[model samples]
Target: MAPSNQLEVPQKSRVTVVGSGNWGSVAAKLIAFNTLHINSFHDEVRMWVFEETLPSGENLSDVINRTNENVKYLPGIKLPKNVVADPDIEHAVRDANMLVFVTPHQFMEGICKRLVGKIREDAVAISLIKGMEVKREGPCMISSLISEILGISCCVLMGANIANEIAVEKFSEATVGYRENKEIAEKWVQLFNTPYFMVSAVQDVEGVELCGTLKNVVALAAGFVDGLEMGNNTKAAIMRIGLREMKALSKLLFPSVKDNTFFESCGVADLITTCLGGRNRRCADAFARNGGKRSFDELEAEMLQGQKLQGVSTAKEVYEVLSHRGWLELFPLFTTVHEICSGRLAPSAIVEYTEHSARLPLLESPVHLN
Candidate 1:
């Protein structure tokens, strides 16, 4: 049936990316292409730049707007014309109906606080961030923080997506985790899907998100093994143990999370990609090379340029949760990663301190979650 004249016209959706890092820039590139092709979405894509000066003393935002490239973070790749770089977060997201939050997870709370009562009432958000916030009460996922602070329904996108490879249009896959709204989730799928970038939607938000977050801790362990020059079999063993821990931790935290979600792009695929190529693995390799003499903060600054490794902080945060709940003894790998990162144990101990040495007596038993 045709709508009457009194019926309101649907408002076109405007897109804004509230970050300017490597992944953030790639995310803008992907969304810019989609918004222009989809009639329901506005042509302009606003990306919020934290506003830094380049080494040559040029304004980063101005350079991106003039050159159509994120000259500092994601150099050498051309961004779409519609992807406008804005320095002001408020102005960038002013008229935006679809906000993509991709900043480092640590800054999200402050960012959300600034967006309270400022964003569109109907705005929906999706987090491309892979880290989680651990409060004294418990852990808070980025999606939950956004929903609580902005009063918006938020979903999460995660997988084995590396920023540089995705920017060059390599084949990759991602998973969108939604709470309930299938329609909203499909809209996100449309906004992100590309020929080279495949996207899928799943109903298990916590499962997909934990897969993304917890994998960082595991990646750190993988890095330690690499630094130790352990053979392929040893690394494979670490990976297998890490995968079991990841699934067990997820199930213990959120029982509703499906077992099969671990088989999706956000699960095993992400774990493999991150372990092999992610910054955490790279830095962990370096940390091991130095014999843990230099602190992670110092190494991060020297090794990663300005980019932060999510695994180091994530391992610490996960440790906090495990300790608070008296579950540290149950999670041997996680506990060891934190201890090793904090310089308590040598890199080689990644193998020595197995579940056998921990307080758990069922180390030889089959993988089962209590």
Candidate 2:
């Protein structure tokens, strides 16, 4: 053995992506590329796959390892050869010092519980999941939940990201939201930034994450307009009203939320893109076209293969928070979106409720912090 006085080399950071859906796979590709080129990180990336058997009776993880493609979720795009797929969640994350959480919001609580004692104590996390969980006390952001449960600092990444487009190296921009550590945020930006995918970091975590969560609700309203075949003027009006409500609700919930955060790629740009072309909009369009008879569940399975729709569920979660706090009237566009989504109102009600409710003043009452 070497002498005790001899200096030991520092360990390079290892990364594990905890989910392997469409977005998760793309995130792995981006991180894998950066790690291979950057000296500070390990070149190999581990991706946790929720094993499913294909019709051909092959395990999803096996197929991914053999073909270097997620044929079930994201077909045709080859993940980097260094992005190894692991069927075991604990095994996937055990050795990594950086964890990327990209699973559905609803499943996050359970996932966090499973990871409590499994992850390295010094590991840092970033959430790409764009939703929230409503606990008995109040609404908890996914990053907050990860931090609280796993005893680690968690940041978030959100923007006008359409995963499939990013997978093809199309140009896009994303924002990294951090609570305090700017250095950690920059490291995350570096891991994700590329010539085609530009990334920037901001100090407002809640604002950025809330922007990502609330935009899906707005996208549903936009979809209703599209399904109704409304003209560009009407669609633009809907988008404007939705953005105002998003800002109002975010500020009212987290009084510390920055107004300028609404100008970032995670804010107005994400709202616009999700409204125009995201899966939430596409599925909501189908829900409206079917006269709201077909549930979002049926439409999601039919349209998305296996991907989850954030808008319908996010609308429900936001409705719970609004109704609990008696702020529904203040957020007319938000209220109407959830009402229409849950079958309490017809899809056509989006136009009437939003138009009438936009006239009311918002956040006039005391802000309730949860």
Candidate 3:
């Protein structure tokens, strides 16, 4: 028989989102919907807003708290009433046993450092950011960095999810990449899945993440193809080559990575969408249209407003990794993307390099088929 004096657990399971940007807002909205319907979760989804002033002279957090929307980042969308926005990151993460991190990859390390000793001991995290940090040791995935810094298990969610489309409740699918815990992964699926947004879990975190990371570099190449007014055949060729390089790099980095994971929403789906419609592609298109006269930094400022592009940085980082490991010759597409981005080669050189590399057997190696 159970003891009558046993302590009862709180009916409300707390959740917090560690970002309030475009994707962050959508994640909060999705989690807010689930928290209301899923009895195990707390109704209020706390979203940490990195405080900033909008074009108007208003506090962003106050506006979000009052209007129940992230008007600046995700304008024209109504967030649920239960989604609370706070500027205090520490306060935001204090009680949250489940944390969703969707901030820009550049700011993630600082954010993780700040959260030290503040979160619950049993907290689990999910990283939606796509990119990595290249140190002297090597490229560290955002999820891995989070796990190492925060002393928590971190899962990743990646897909062909465009924030604007998801914000409007358009149908989409995402993959949750976890290490070993199926039950934990399912909880994440429950938090994110909806009629419009389907979520599935897989055990290959590195494959899903590398697909998300490297696809941006490919998108840059695709954007060049678009800027050059290249036809569909050229763009298709670039994508095919990019996908092959993506698989090779992922397997090279982590032998445990599964080839089938590349078929999931996080892999090919992400690569396709990013090349066709992502911000990186758009900016790269602009860079190419201008004949590479202006730098990507200048275009990103003029075009993206305040948002950052991940591809350009990812290219340099990946190139650094390849160079350090003496593996640059093994990845022609990857190396060429960086060289082109740095103006060492013309935008047209994207095609030229890939074509030249293809004719040669430089990238050949004994590898598993994807």
**For model 1, what is the C-alpha lDDT against the true structure?**
0.90
| Best candidate according to lDDT | 2
Q: What is the C-alpha RMSD of each candidate to the true structure, in Å?
A: 2.7, 1.6, 2.3
Superposition TM-score, candidate 1 onto the true structure = 0.95
lDDT of 2 at 93: 97
Over 4 Å off, model 1 = 1-9, 355-370
Worst lDDT run of 10 residues, candidate 2, spans 361-370
Per-residue alpha-carbon lDDT of candidate 2 for residues 146-181, written as tens digits (9 for 90 to 100) = 999999999999999999999999999999999999
lDDT-wise, the better of 1 and 3 is 3
Pairs of colliding residues, candidate 2:
none
- TM-score of every prediction relative to native: 0.95, 0.97, 0.95
Model 1 — which ten-residue stretch has the worst lDDT? 357-366
| Cα lDDT, all candidates | 0.90, 0.92, 0.91
Clashing pairs in 3: none
Backbone clash pairs for candidate 1 read none
lDDT score, candidate 1, position 359: 38
Q: Which scores better on TM-score, 2 or 3?
A: 2
Q: Please provide, for model 1 over 145-212, each residue's C-alpha lDDT reduced to its tens digit, 9 standing for 90 to 100.
A: 99988899999999999999999999999999999999999999999999999999999999999999
Reference-based lDDT, residue 129, model 3: 94
